[model samples]
Target: MSRKRVAEPGPLSEHVPGRKKACWGILTSQGSWADRSPLHEAASQGRLLALRTLLAQGYHTNIVTIDHVSPLHEACLSGHVACVRALINAGANVNAATIDGATPLYNCCASGSAACMELLLQNGAHTHTTHAHFPSALHEACKRGYSQCVESLLSHGADPDYGVAHLGSALYMSCLHRHTECSRILLHSGAKVNVGRDSDSPLHAAVRQDSADQASVLLDYGADVYLRDSNNQRAVELAPPGGKTHQLLLTFEVAPRTLCQLCRLHIRTVIGPSRLKQLPVLPLPSLLTHYLEYT
Candidate 1:
C-alpha cells in the first residue's frame, strides 16, 4: 500500500495552496471522517515509530475527528496492534464511539483482530454495546466468520442470541452467511437454535444459503425444520430441489431421531453448554467423554 503524504499541524491545512498535490493522501478527507489529526494518520497507516513520536510529543491520544473517531478507532480499523497499543497506553479511550455508533472495539471486531479485542476488553471495552442502531461486536464477528473473535466476545459475556434491529441473532447471521464454524460456536455457547429474525429460523437461513453442513449443525443443536419465517415458509420450502441441503432435509424428515443422538442431546442439556468444556475431565470413559463433547 502506498503511504499518503502527511500535512503538518491539522487536517484543515491540507487545503493550502501548492500543498494540494502532496496532500492527496488525506485529500479524501480522511476517508470522509473529517478533521483527522496527525495521530489518526499515524495510527491508520501503522506508522508505529512516528505514532510513538507523536505520543511522546504530547499529542492528545483521545482526539477525535469530526465523526468522533479516535486514534484508537483508526488503529483498530486497520488492524494495527502496535499503534493500538501505543494509543491505549497513551490514554486513548477504548470505548470511544463514532457519531454513527462505531466504537474502537467494534472496529476490532470488524477487522477480526482478536489481540486488539482482548486488549480492549482488558481495558473495559464493553463486549456488548447497548447501541440499538448498530450491530453488536458479537454480531459483526459471527457475520464475518471471525471464529476467534466470536469466541473472545462470548468468553467476555456477550449474549449469543442478542438480536440487532434488522440483523437478527449472531447465529442467524453466521448461518445466513454460510459460516458453519461460527454457527457451531454460537450454538455451543447457548444460542437458541430456533430464535432468529422475526420468524426466519437459523435452519431457514441455512437452507436458504444451501449450506448442508450448517443445516446439519443446527439440526444437531435442535433447530426446528418446520418453523415458519416472516414469509410463512418452512426451511424445506427454501431448499433448492435436489440440492445437498434438500437431500439432507428430506432424509432427516424421513427418519426418526436416533437413540444415541437423543442421548447425546439429553446429556448436553444436563451438562449445560457453558460447562461443555469440562466434559473431557469428568473421569468417565473416553468414549463417553467423546460422545458428550462431540469430540
Candidate 2:
C-alpha cells in the first residue's frame, strides 16, 4: 500500500517550486491508464490504502488529468467517502473544476451520495458550479432521480431553477425522467411548477414522458394546466392518446380549482420560496398547515 519516492530526474522530477510532484510517470506506467494519475485511480476505485499512501508519498492531491479532473473529482464521482475525506484532509481543492466546469460537488450529486455531498459542502464546495451539460448540482440530482441528493442540495441553498437555459429547470428534468420523488421534493422546496424552457413546461415534459404520477404532483402544486409549449401544444395535447396521463390532464383542465385551493396557492406565492418551510409552524390548524405544505 506504500510507494517509494524515487528522486530520479524524469517527467515527475521537474519540480515546480512549492508544488507537489505531478504523477505523470505513474499515469504512463500502464497502457490502460491513459490520462489518469495514480491518485485518480486509487480514489476512483475506493482504494483507501493506496490513496492514503499516495498522499503520504508527496503525490499532489491537486494534480489533474488532461481534462482538468482532480483526484477529488474522481472520489466524489465514485461516492468513495473515505477517499473524499482523505483528499480533503490532504488539502485537495474541493472547488476544482473539470474542463467542462463540473466541480466535485456536482459529481457527488451525479452519483447520488448525500454523505459525499454533505462533506463537500462542509469543506467549502460551491453548489452553484455549473457545467456545459449540467446547469447545477441540483439539476444533476434531479436528472438522475436522486431525491436525497436533491434534498441535501436544497437544504444547502442550491437553486431549484438553476439550469433553466440549457437543461431546463430541475423540476423539468425530474419530470422528464419520471422521478416522482425528486419532483415532489423540488416542488415542496418551492421550485417553479410552471417554469420551463422555451420548448416545454414541466407538465409538458412529464406528460411527454408519460409520467402520470409526476404530472399529478405538478397539478397538485398548482402548475398552470393551460400552458403551451413551443410547438403550440398544451400539456394535455402532448399526453399519450387514451392514456392515463391524458385523462389526468383532461380532468384537471375541465375541473375548476376550489376557492380554498386558490387561496393556498396564493399564500404559497406570497410567502415565496424562502418562507415556504415556515408554513408548518404558523398558527393555522394542523390540516390547513398540512395543506399549505402540500402534504
Candidate 2 local Cα displacement, residue 187, angstroms:
0.5
Model 2 residue runs over 4 Å out of place are: 1-34, 130-135, 281-284
How high is the CA lDDT of each candidate model?
Answer: 0.81, 0.81
Clashing pairs in 1: none
lDDT of 1 by residue, 1-295 (tens): 1123323534447557755332322334333333667888899999999999988987678876666778898889889998888888888888887777888888887899999898898888988777687647888888889999998888887877788969888898999899899998888877788988888788998898899999999988777788888888889889999999999999999885789988888778777756776777788999898776666
- For candidate 1, which ten residues in a row score worst on lDDT? 1-10
User: Global lDDT for candidate 1?
Assistant: 0.81
Q: After superposing candidate 1, which stretches have Cα over 4 Å from the reference?
A: 1-34, 270-273, 277-286
Instruction: Provide the TM-score for each candidate, comma-separated.
Output: 0.84, 0.86
lDDT of 2 by residue, 1-295 (tens): 0111334334534556654443454443342222567888899899999999988998888877656778888888889999999899999999887767788988888788999999998988877864445447888788888999999888888777666477788888888888999999988888889997766889999989998999898888898878889888888888889999999978887886889888988888898898887787788899888888877
* Model 2 alpha-carbon miss at residue 38, Å: 1.5
- For candidate 2, list the clashing residue pairs, or say none: none
